[model samples]
Target: MRAASEILAVWHAFDDFPMETLTKAWHYRSGNEPKQRSVELMRLHRERYGSSGNCFDLALWLIDAFRREGISAYAVGHDLLTPNAHVAVAALDGRGRAYLCDLGDQWIEPILIDAGSGDFTEEPLAGFVSGARVALSVRDSWLHVVYLRPNGKRSEQTYDLRPIAPDALLAAGEYSQRLLRKPLVERRIYTETEVLHWELGDDASYLSGKRGRTEEEPMRSLADRVERIHRHTGMDRQVIEQALTVYGTASIQFD
Candidate 1:
């Protein structure tokens, strides 16, 4: 339990780090290596742009951090064929208990996946998500998660706990970086009572929590949107402008 708690503590530190593609969109530099970016590059991006890449990038960052802290962590994922596939870290504690650490989808914190852990319980865990309760069950080698959200809506995902080969992971990361969708971002902001998701996307932006959701005021112009994104995300003005400009051009091309 102590080991899992330590992993959880590391996961909590990233609540403020956004999982977005803007930084990579603008600061891209092609190379021979696979798309798993170095933590140093991510640091430079955060310092200069205040934004980061998608799930693959975030997973890489977290795994590297765990290793530096002397923790045994590895990358895992599912939906390997989809561009929208997910990636996350499976960190093992001193006793080899594995905890699922997901920051890309921006989970509130890490959760214990090993049912064999000392403190593992059957009760659904709340607070890890807003407006929902998370239930974990392990079948064979996979950890299955079910989110019971409002209106009886049930969402499910399974993590293939088997460790991914570094080369394969990097190849997938490279493939993921090639694709960019709408100019968007999602971040988690937690309060004493609930977790709030701040989302900015193609059509509308809003803040959603357990109680309700509030729409963000629309930006008046391109420059206005850049300023607002910077204010809300603390990304550098220059970086935001450059990245958004690429998306704007892509929109024009597609249109």
Candidate 2:
């Protein structure tokens, strides 16, 4: 089994990586089409102009980073046919034990996946101070991850354990950008920070931040949304303006 100390180290290194806004215009503008190459995405992340992407972007970067550190890792996903599909990284420690490291999902620590049994629940690194509990159970060939907060609230995500190939993952990325009815794709500008979620839509702009604070404002014009994103995310002003000009002009409905 991978030592708890080692897993904790990797978890802390990537825990705070920002999950930025992704728009269809920005997706195609990266190149002729959505490019799923981790190297290119990582390069963009290093460049201030390239910090924004969806879950696949985040998972791909994590896979590359883990491999560079000599950890055996691969990209995994579930619900490929649905709009709610999600991606994450699976890492194998020195002792051949597998763990789930999902920065995009904002998991505080790596979760241990027990393969032999259909049910399991445990703290990531027992004796390490953390307020989250991870529980795994298998049903109908789907692995469910239940993340429980110290206050008794819980969030659950499920995925297939089968490893996803790079080409397949790339294709999935394209489908999600084009065909998936996701809020990320529908919103003119969507962003999630550590404690906030901002989405600009046709009718109204929604803002939700820490401590259950949520408010709505009249929809701002495309230009205004771009400026708001620029001011809020610290992304390049020119890049945001260009993307909004090219992609944000479409008429989209809000929920």
Give the number of the best model, judged by TM-score.
1
What TM-score does candidate 2 reach?
Answer: 0.67
The sequence of per-residue lDDT tens digits that candidate 2 reaches over residues 1-255 is 233566667656654354543433455556655445455655665475734566777777777777777788887878664566688878877766667776555554566675653333443332111334466775654677665555567677787767889888878766655541322311122235333434544344554333332445553566666666555555666766665554445455211
Q: For every model shown, what is its TM-score relative to the native structure?
A: 0.87, 0.67
Task: Compute the lDDT of residue 245 as modeled in candidate 2.
Answer: 56
After superposition on all CA atoms, how large is the RMSD of candidate 1?
2.9
**What are the lDDT scores of the predictions, listed in order?**
0.76, 0.57
The candidate maximizing lDDT is 1
Error of 2 at 85 (Å): 2.2
Q: What does each candidate score in C-alpha RMSD?
A: 2.9, 6.0
Q: Candidate 2: RMSD over Cα atoms?
A: 6.0
Error of 1 at 214 (Å): 2.5
- Candidate 2: where is the Cα deviation over 4 Å? 1-3, 7-11, 21-24, 115-134, 139-141, 147-155, 179-224, 244-247, 251-255
